[model samples]
Every structure is written in structure tokens, then in C-alpha cells.
Target: MSERVGAGKSGRKKVRDGIEGAKVVELRPKQGAASDKAEQDSEDRRFIHRDNGIWRRKGDNPPTFICGPVDVLAESRDEEGRNWGLLLAWDDRDGHRHEEAFPRALFAGDGNEIRSRLADGGLTLGAGTSAKAAFLEWLASLASEQRARSVTRIGWHAFGGQSAFVLPDETIGEAGERVVLQTTEREASLFGVSGTAEDWRREIGLMCAKNSRLVFAASCAFAAPLLGLLGEEGGGISFKGDSRVGKSTALRVAASVCGGTPQNGAGGYIRSWRSTSNGIESTALASCDALLPLDEMGQLDPREAGEIAYLLSNGQGKARSSRTGGARSVARFRILFLSTGELGLADLNREAGKATKAGQEVRFADLPADAGRGMGLFEYLHHEDTPEAFARYLRTATGQIYGAPLRIFLRRLADVMANEGEDELRGRLRDRIADLADDWLKDYPAASGQVRSVAARFAMVAVGGELATSYGLTGWADDTPSYMAGECFHAWLAERGTVGRREEEQAVQQLRDFIARNGEARFERWVDAVTAAEAQSEIPDAPPGERFRTQNRAGWKRWVREDDGKSAWRYLLTSEAMSEALSGLNQRSAKAVLVERGFLLPGKDGKIAAPISPPGHKKVRAYEVMAAILGSDEGDR
Candidate 1:
């Protein structure tokens, strides 16, 4: 039998045996109907659909669906014409809600993009490759709808108590016993609400009461919230000393009164001096009506040091330009910041070869970090292992028990103002501070006006501490705070010296230093000759009686006479030499000052140069400076 391929009625190829005339039937492939149904089910499972304007998972019904309630708070279109939305989403599992900025393109993209973006806002969607597409489609539809109206931006009074106080997590207001308004967006976390008022008193409050330096630092921190009401300008207090001396630790202790950590790591309260001015500006705003702690003054650039000090203390940010070249809103803050450094601002500038300005010194008042007696930044460690160990303990303890005292203080101040009236309370506090200032300045009768102002600032911090104690916030004896503050302020004043005389003393020291350094190398003096004849010939004779008879030259006679043994060794500095030696001052002015002070003698020609040596070989006009004036003692003056 010969086999031939033939088409069967079922459209299958068949083999026939020609000799036997018998045909064989073949089976054909079946249609994939079940596989198609399975794929359809998967696609349906992947795509998330919306029910009643809420997104629902594929298998979820009424009770099983996640109820996150992602609300579109506000919407805007960027320059690229892409829509952007600010969303406040709630996570039921975590019981936390966070605000996020979402772009429309993310929702319009694949499901993975949608899932990833929502996940960033703390939302987790059901997992599946096909589910992402459905979620993305649902998100896109949601984005197309009308956005919720933008709520009015609340005006926050950083320094004064108002109906509402804006915090990191919410806006706490006095609508009915301090309601938490969770709808407002917080741009910066100046203050927070954590722990309890009692916890703060136990941890940070008691610590400040025991340590005078910590008390002053914490007092400065507390003063920040009342700066506006107090009508005081913003400024910073720097604790400066050697490395590992607990300067930064003291600042951290102060920072704990608010929301900052005392640890020296990421997200800790201590800020570095190496940041740009703009970064510092933002930091100041973030610390509005609170404490701003800066660490490591040695890290700051010398050129920007003065500018940063002035900017921060001035309570304003550098004006910035917007995209359209228009002026952006200036960032402002009124705060009392604590800073740490191995060197004071003046010494730091001097090391960089820059002169320290007086204003810069006043702006950042430097207090010695070492409290003396081998205790760094502390008079006693409150019976802890060591200062370092105590500092470490504070760092840990404060991180947990912070942010409550500030709220209580504010609330108490508000209540006082409401019951007693704003002006009365302010006047009473002002009088108390003024009395403290008088006590500090009573002994410093000749204190400069600026010194009085600085003393007042220190007094304010002390008074604030006393007030906190009076309010039962700090568990300290009533009189202890003021007494310690006065003692500390007295020490600072003594270290600062007579303020108005600082410039004069510095100038005199500079002149003395120049003379001492170059006395042998640059100055000329006639030594005693081998014989009296030689000495007599080398010395110039008095010109005439008329030389001593010159008018308006009273001091000339005393220095121009023939040299006695005591005056014979006096150094003669020429006008050119004097100019070079006193380069920090005008040549003529320096000579006049010396003459007026009786250190130099005036000449018959109404000039300052006197003839101490034999008309020196070149007949140079020179002045005679008493060797006593060039001594190290003169420089100390």
C-alpha cells in the first residue's frame, strides 16, 4: 500500500493507503480558552479600580479595602506644565500621617511608580505586576479631579504667645484648651511637643539648677521665646575654650530645653561653623524663637566670621533673588544661640591674620568654658563619674525628655499676660532686669555704655532663670539663680576688662611690641664712649638757652639737657623709625600722644624729635624714648 498525504474534513493532515483504499484520521490541536481566561483574570487582578472616589485593591470588598484617605491638599503646575500636588496621607498601620509633594507624572506612569511614590509617603499597596498598572490608572484619574482649596497660611508669632503656636507636628491653639490643628504644613521645626513637663523638670531642669554655667546657658535658651515681648535684639553667647572641655556639652544642655539633641552627630542640635552663610540663615529661621547651638568656631572661615555674627545677631537673613530676579521674602529670626569653639571670635580672627573688630566682640560674647578647679564647664558634676561621663549622660537623658518645658513656659507666660495684663508683666520683668543690671554695674562704675548693655543681656538671662524658678518650672531655691548669675557676670566683666580703654590699651601694647621687637635691630642709640672726652664729643651740646626758652614746649627742657648717667642710655628713634615702629598708628599722632603722655620730649621747633645722640653721623632728627617706656611693663598697660 502506498501512503499519500490528504486533507481531512477536520482540517488535519491524513495518511491513506492506496492499495487497501483505507484512510487514517489524525487529531488536531485544541483552542487555548482556559489559558486566555487565566490571563484575563490576572490583568483584572493587577488593575486597581476606584469605588466612590477611593482606591480599592483587586480582591478587596467593602470591609477589606485599605482606608488611607490620601487627601489632595493643594495643587500647582510647574513651568513644564506638569501638575504637582501636596498630599496629606494617613497610614492606618503606623497610625501616622505625613505630608508629601507628589508630581502628576508619577501617577500617570506605570503602577510600580505609583506604588513607590505612595510608599514614600508611608503608604503600602498590595503587591503584583498587574496591580501597579491599575493603581497608576486610578491615581491618574484622581489627579484629574479638582484639588481641595488651599488653606490660608497661618501667621506664627515666634516670640510671643498667640492663639496658636506652630510646632513641628501640628498647630496647637487655644480654641478650647489647646487643640491640635493637624492640617497646617510646618516649614521648619522650631519647637516640638514630647515627653511631659515633669520629665523636663526632672532631667534638664534640675541639672541647670545645680550647675551655674548650665543654668546661665539654659536661661539664655529660655529667653529666646520672649525676645519680642522683652523688646531685645537677637544675639549669641559663645562658650570658648580648649578642645574636649565640655563647651559643646554645655550648649547641648541648653539646646535640650527645646527640640535639639545634644549629641554631636547627624540631626544633633549642635551646628558646625563650616556651613555657608545661606545654610546658617536657614538654620536661624528653623530656630526662630528658640535656641541655635553652633559648634567648633575654629572651623569657620575668618572672612565670614564677622558677617555671620552680625547677621545672626541682627535677626535677619541676607536678601536672596528669586527665579524671576525679584526679591524673595527675607528670612528673619529672633533667637539666643549657644556656640562652642577652641578660640573666641577675636582670637580666631587674629589667628587668621585679621583684626578683630569691637562690634564683633560684643555681638558674640565669649565666656570661658572651663569653670576652673579642674572641672570643665562645670563647678561640680553633680556627683557624676566625671564631667565627660556626666555630659554623656545628659546627652542621652536630654534626647528623651526634651521639648516640654518650652511649651509649658509659653503657656504659663500667656496665662500671666492674660490675667495680669501684658504691659504690667513686661514692666515688672524689665524693672527686675534693670535692678540686676544695677547690681552688676555698681562696682564697674567706669564701665563703658556697651558694657552696660552686655551686662543687661547677661542679667536678662539670669532673671529669666529666676522667673522660671519662680514659676515652679525649675526646682531651684528662689535666690540661688540671681546670685549665681551675678557671680558669673562679674567674672565675665573682669575678664573683659575696662571696655572703653581696650582700644587705647591695645594701641599702646602694639607700639610697645614694635619697639621691643626692633629696638636692637632697627633703632639707633649712642653707647658710652671709651673715655669721658669721647662721650662728651659724641653727645650734642644744648643749642642755646633760647632752645630751652621755646614757648609751648614745656616738656622739652626736661629731655634736651646734657645727659646724666641715668638718662645717657636712652634710645633715640628717628621720625622715619618711629613711623615704621608705630605703623599701627599715624607717625605724627603717635609722637604727639607720647609727648602728651610724657614718654617723649618736644623739640624747640615744635616737633616731636629730640636730640639724644650726638647729631648722629647723618644728622637725623630723632626722638628720645625713655628706656622705661620700652620695658615689658609698658606693654602690659
Candidate 2:
């Protein structure tokens, strides 16, 4: 046993071994069982405590540990109700940072899933027999005593203001500088950087000179960023025509203004119409406050075409259920999309034996691609080579110089809005559109309401393009866009015909077609005895009887008779034959309409039919239409 020692300044005893020369050392008091247990409890409390899936440090203001190379930007649930996290991660090998969605289960999972995901993302956990164990060990090493700062949570839908310009990896603003966020792991690699402002102007100027549609589409793309500021419901425009007629090229050109080319597939700016409504809703949300270009309208299911159009234009998604049976947040967007297809939306549905609604038709206006000048989608090929060659050149040139114009345009628009306020800018744009619409419809007074609406949409595109030019984003002659717009608008009007007169014209054409088809076969002759004698007899001085003779027919005829002491020629049609000829029209309603238009005379009992006696047949009821109502022979044709 050690010998008892004297008390030291610390009030603890100094102990000495039994050996005489052994140096004395201070000895601590032997702790009681309760004290030892208390110490043990304190030590146990120092370890991290996890509650409700969140890890918390033990000390005051303890730090939260998160691994690098990947950060969870948002949390969401998939269609099947599985927990998901939108992650912004870096890939050092490719020097590209991408946003990927991963299962939350993997992060909390027993190592294997996490390791597999990391490996799939091109990350290595070093040589280890147990990758799960290694990953866990590595995650543990990230823990530190430093306090963790709060991270800004980015919403999935980035709409309203410059925030809507957020890309997969960065947020772009009016300043033309990237607003570097915590989740921005790398610079934007897809859009690259904006070329010199003059480079964009030159390229766009060439497009403007080449095709009015191209200029219209490009301007729409540039003005898309201002849509949110415009404070109006969002809509889209479609470029529809035959395949390989430069429709796709125009869309690609428009896409180049924003970022990415037409061929970038899913990751690029262009999307396919082959997706489901939900899929498109997601795409639209991703493209909020930007240009969303969809390719191949023919790819969509005919049954869903109308609904899809309504959904996209309305900027809302279907509400869904979550795993817990609660309502999931519906996806929303405010964007102007550009669509390209070989067939127009209505024609596409018609081919599939599906009918399109009027709302769908108005939402996506169908303009004839042939510009009515023998040019297919282009009036003149501005490039030295053929249109195809120019398209190929554009594919490469556009990819090289993307994203800058949109950035600069947004910056400039923001500056203007900041200085003059949003209302002033929107009011100016509205006034411009109104003025353009008035000019476009000046000659189309009888245009249908739908036609006028479509014209307004075209005018909007025109106004948007012209505004971009006026803003100096596109280097073109100031009047070039307006001229192109007017030309396109007129061409559309010419091909579509007068809108308001469509129904009346259809009625008239139907009547003419019926008469032309059956007039000679269906009706019998109704010549008076005296007229018949005169027609059969040869006059001595007459030159083959050149004077007009009333030769009656069974189905229709024109007869000149004295009425109220005035000679008038009455256009007559047998009631039975008229009913068969104009079967599409309601006989009573058509007669009333004809009477109102002065086409027919109302007889006794307010009926349009009159009693007529043939030379050798029984009396018959015939419709006596006025000759003046039929107009000239040229008008009938």
C-alpha cells in the first residue's frame, strides 16, 4: 500500500511509494460511485442527438453539418408519392453542375443507396470494401464545431420579377451579372456566355431581313422576360406548316435568343410535345417567365391536344394528392411558349378524328406558313447558301452565341421599369399593341371576333419584336419589324378570308353549289303557252333570236312579270327542290333571313312560297326570290 502523504497547496494529498527515494506526486481523491455515474451521464449527453430526422449538436449554438459537392435545394414528392429532394450538385470531371432530384430515403438510408447515387453521379468514395461504411465515415468527418448559417430556400417555381430568370444552376438579373447563390455550384455551361452585343444584333438583323416570322418569333422570345412585368395572363404562339419548310429553323432561331438550341433535347431549351400534361406542366414551370419552345405538335395525343393547350395557356397545373392524402401544391407558370409542328393544332386533332374547341383554336392561332408569295416560310433566303445550308449554319452559330441577348434585354427592361415604373412600361406596350391592332384591322371591318383576336396576338408579337428593336437589343432598321409584321398579318388575312363573313359566305356557297349541281336535272320547264309559241316561231328579221327569252326550268327560274304596275324579274325555285338543295339550312330560318336581307318577297300568310301555275301541270308552291337579291352573274360565281 502507498504511504499517506502531506496535503499540498491544492488541498490534495501527495502520495509516495514505499521506496525511500521515490518522488512524491499529487493524488486525486477517489470519486464515489454517484460522482462517477454523473460524469458518465455528462459524457453521454455530449454526443449528437437526432430528433424527427434532423440532427442537432449538443452544445449551445451548435453547427449543422452538410456535405459538399451536393446541396438539397428543395423538397418534394413524386407522382408515386415518394419523398424527393431537388439537389444542386457539382461534377468535377465534366466541370458541369446540374440539378438532380434524389430520394430523401437515400440520405437517411443505410449507406448503400447513398454510395450508389454518388457513384452514379461520378463521385468516388475511395477504395473500400464497404462503400456504405466509407460514405458514413466520410459524412461523419464533415461535422464541426462551427455554427451553420441558414440557407436560402429556392422555390421550384421562380416567377415574378428577375427571380423568375433563375436557371438550373444560377439566377440571372437585369445587372447582367449572375447572382451567385449557395446552390450555384458552377457557372452556366449550357447557355455559355453572351457574345458582344453587336454580334447578337448582326445575327438577329439577318434573321429579320430573311423572314418576318423569324423576327416575330425572336422578338417574342426577347420580350418573354417582360411578360411577368406586363401583368397580363400568359399565352403562346405556334409556327405550323409542312415539314422541312424552315418552321423548325424559325423556332430554333427564337430559342437561340433565350439560351440553348432547338436540338438540345430535354436539357436544352426545346421540349417535345410527346409528353403528358403533367410532364408539360413541369416543363412550363421550369420555364416560368422565359421562352418555352415545344417541338412537333403532331407528337401529342389528339384527345389531349385541346386540354393541353388550355392548361399551358392558362398557366396552371392539375392539383394532385400526396402520400399522406393531403393536397400537393399545384405547379404554376406564366410563360410565352413557342411551338413548331407540321400540322396546325386543329388539323392535327382532325387527322386523329378528334374535334377541337374554339377556345383552343384562339389560344394557338393557326397562320398559313406559305406567306402566299410562293415562298415557303421565308420570302427571301438571306444567306449565300440555300435555306437548308442557312439552317445548318444557324444550328451552329446560334449555339455559339446564346443567352446574352436575353440577359441584356432583361437588364434593359428592368432598368426602364425601375425608372418609369411597371405600369408605365406596360401601358406603353399596350398602347403600341392597340395601335398595331387598329392598323392591322383597318381593312377587315367584317372580320370575325375570333379573327380579330388572332390578329391581336399577331400584333402583339409584332409589337414585342418592334419594341426589342427600339430598345436596341436587335440591330435592325427601325421599320423592319413593323413592315414584317404587317406583311405577315396581311398574308394571314388573305389566306383565312374575312372572318365575320365566313358563315354567310358558307351559306351562299352552299346554295350556289346545290343549284349548280341539280338545277338542270331536278326541275321541270314552266314556259307559258304564248312564250312557248314565240320561242318556237322563227322571226323574219331576227338574227337567231338574240334577245333574252325566259326559258323556265323545274328546279329554278327567273320570270319577268307585271307586279303592282311595275315589271320585275323574280328568281323562282320549287319549294320541294329548294328544301332538298339547302338541306343544311333551316328552311324557315333561312327564308326569314332571306326576307330580312331582301332576297325574298313575303306573300299572304307571311310565307316566302308563292302559288305558280305551269302551262300543262297542276299549280305548285315556289319560292320567289328577288332577282336583285341574287345580284350580278359575277357575284353568283
Off by over 4 Å in 2: 1-164, 173-197, 261-267, 324-326, 373-375, 383-385, 501-637
What digit string (tens of lDDT, one per residue) describes model 1 on residues 2-113? 2323334223222212212222111111222224443343232222323222333432222123324454443434324334543444444476766554555455445455
Kindly report which residue stretches of model 1 are placed more than 4 angstroms away from their true locations once superposed.
1-69, 72-93, 99-120, 123-165, 170-194, 261-267, 324-326, 499-501, 517-565, 568-629, 632-637
Give model 1's clash tally: 5
> How many Å off is the CA of 173 in candidate 2?
4.1
TM-scores for every candidate against the unseen true structure: 0.67, 0.61
lDDT of 2 at 526: 44
Tell me the deviation in Å of residue 390 in model 1: 3.2
lDDT of 2 by residue, 136-172 (tens): 6434322211111111222222323323245544554
* Candidate 2 lDDT: 0.58
